[model samples]
Every structure is written in structure tokens, then in C-alpha cells.
Target: MEELTLTTPALLFSAISLIMLAYTNRFLAYAAVIRNLSEKYRERPQDSLIRQIDNLKLRLNLTRWMQIFGISSLLLCVLTMFLIYINQHVVAVWIFGTALILLILSLAFLIREIQISAQALQHHLSDMEESLKK
Candidate 1:
């Protein structure tokens, strides 16, 4: 295996920063939706609204996990760079590998969240189609 250098882990800095920004944006969007749904539910509670809120709750949890893992990955990447800087090349390589794994897990959660979001949209579309047919 090639020697682990500070530059190697440093490479993830930009990519991780971009991913974290995107995740934060997603989280903010979800918060807005939840707030809007809460107001509607308060005005007049309905089964559909309750269902939507439930779905949002699950999605929110998933988003939280995604952020957690992504941030952890970024943190690990930084730690890896520090290790390399201090001449701990072997440990740095291990830390970098773990960081990569965490990133992959974060992306998996994102994929699951997107799937749930698409399914929710599909449900709304189906309801609209049924109403139109009536």
C-alpha cells in the first residue's frame, strides 16, 4: 500500500463540505414542511394530514441520521489528516477507510429517504387521480 499523506484525506474536505451543505438544506426544507403541516393539523385535524405528519416524522429521523453519519465522516477525515500530519500513517489509513464507510452509509440513508419521499408523492398523485375519476 502507498504511504498515506495529509493531502490524501484533505481531498475529502471539499466533497464533504458540499455534501454537508446539501444535507443542511434538506433538513431546513423538512422543517418548513413540518411547520406548515402542524398549522394545518391544528386548524382541522384530518386522517390524511396525520398520515402525512407521520411520514414526515420518519423522514425527519432518516435525515437526522444522514446528517449524523455525514458529519462523523467529515470529522474522521479531519482526524485522518491530523494523524497523517503527526506521522501516524497506518492509523491514518484506517481512519480514512472508516470515514469512507461512514460516507457510504450516509448516502444509503439519503437513498432511502428519497424513496420514501417519492412514494409519498405517488400516494398524493393516486388520490388526485381517484378524485378526478369520481
Candidate 2:
């Protein structure tokens, strides 16, 4: 039992919980930004706001996925820790590692989505500046 202390799953669970909380907070802020923009610059006709709306909708959906994945990871970490405490080494490590990897992959997808949004906004702003100069 003493040897199993080194493999305590509580550490993983704690870290996972913190990471999930941070990610959730970030997504909430992002949603707030989108809501504000949608309310302020919402035009019926086609405009930059349309693209923003599309991006916001997609992001919100992705955020929901993040929540699901975060909770799954959290649960897996807690379960893995308990299993490890009972000396179930193989399955615990395998599952906890898998959950961590999945969580990382989910975050990667979000980063890419945000990058696309930034690029779109930059292109639109540049085009607008060009038109103004004309």
C-alpha cells in the first residue's frame, strides 16, 4: 500500500480539475464576447457580423463538447486514482493517460478554431481599410 502512494491518482485529478475550470472560464468569456458582438452589430443583411455569428455558433457548440470531455476526464482521473490505490496499476495508468491525451486533443481543436477566427477578422478588417482608402 505504501508503494501505491507514489501512484496516487489524486494528483492527476486535481490537475485535471483545475485545467477544466480554466477552460470553462475561457469558454464562458468567449461566449460573452460573442453575445455582446451579436447584440451590438447584428445586421439582418449579409455583413461581417454574419461571419462572426457563424463563428460564435460553432464555438458555442465546441464549448459544449469541451464541457463533456472535461467532465469525462475528471471522472476517469478520480476512478483511476482509486483503482491505483487498490494496486490496479495497468488499467489505471492506461485509462488516466488516455483521458489526459483526449483532453489535450480537445484543447488543440479549440486553439485552431480560435486561430481561424482571428484570421477571418484580420482579412475582413484589411479589406475594409482598403475600401476606405479607395
Candidate 3:
């Protein structure tokens, strides 16, 4: 059995990066949903509006966390990679590997965000239409 010289931290970093990109896309999708929802709320600001507003807040919170995590992970990955490049040729592979993992993680988060946002949009639109018909 071969040991993973790449290190756990490195894999984590790559995963973080992928997550960040994914989250970014998600946030963008959520923004679109917000726009649509806003229009619906404007048409008739009833009690249901509060629920949608809360839902939007939840999504925004997720977006904020994603951004915070993505930025922090990205900076750390870059710094670690640079340090490895300068000081540890032997461990350079592990550092860069970690960085790669972080990048991927960042993107993964973004993807997750997008899927959730799209679903929310679809669900909300259905509800909004149903309400309008009544």
C-alpha cells in the first residue's frame, strides 16, 4: 500500500477551491431567483412574502459563508504553495497537490449552490403562479 504523500491538508485545499467556484455560481443563480422573487413580492406583498424573504436570507447566508470560506482557503493555498516553492523542494509536490485540491473544492461548493438555487427558483415560481391564479 502506498502512502498518500500528497497529504490530507493538500487534498482539503483543492476541495476548497473547487467548492468556492461552485458556490460563486450558486450565488449568481440565487441572485437571479431573488430578482424573480422580488418581482412576485412586489406584485402582492402579503404574508407569504415574509416566508420568501426568509428563504432568501437563508440562501444569502449560505452565499456569504461560501465566499468567506473560499477566499480564506484560496489565500492559504497560494501562500502555502509559494512557501513550498521557496523553501521545500522535497515537499513541493504535497503543497501544490494541496493547492490543487483546494481549487477543486472551491468549484464544488459553487456547483452545490447552483443546484440549490435552481430548485428554489423553480419551487418559488410554482408557488407564485399558484397564488396569482387564486
In candidate 3, position 90 carries an lDDT of: 47
Candidate 1: regions farther than 4 A off = none
Candidate 1 per-residue C-alpha lDDT over 1-134 given as tens digits, one digit per residue, 9 for 90 to 100 = 68888888788889889988988998999999999999999999999999899999999999999999999999999999889888898888999999999999999999999999999999999989999999
Please, what are the lDDT tens digits per residue for candidate 2 over residues 27-89? Answer: 888778887876777545457677777777787777677677777877877777777778888
- Predicted candidate 3 versus true structure: per-residue lDDT over 1-134, tens digit per residue: 34333243455666565766766776787688788878988898877667767777777776776687567666656666566647664465555556556555655655675676687679779998999999
- lDDT accuracy of residue 34 in candidate 3: 80
TM-score of 2: 0.73
lDDT pick, better of 2 and 3? 2
Q: Which candidate ranks first by TM-score, i.e. highest?
A: 1
The order by descending lDDT is 1, 2, 3
TM-score of 3: 0.56
Whose TM-score is higher: candidate 1's or candidate 3's?
1
Compute each candidate's TM-score over C-alphas. 0.97, 0.73, 0.56
Q: Rank by TM-score, highest first.
A: 1, 2, 3
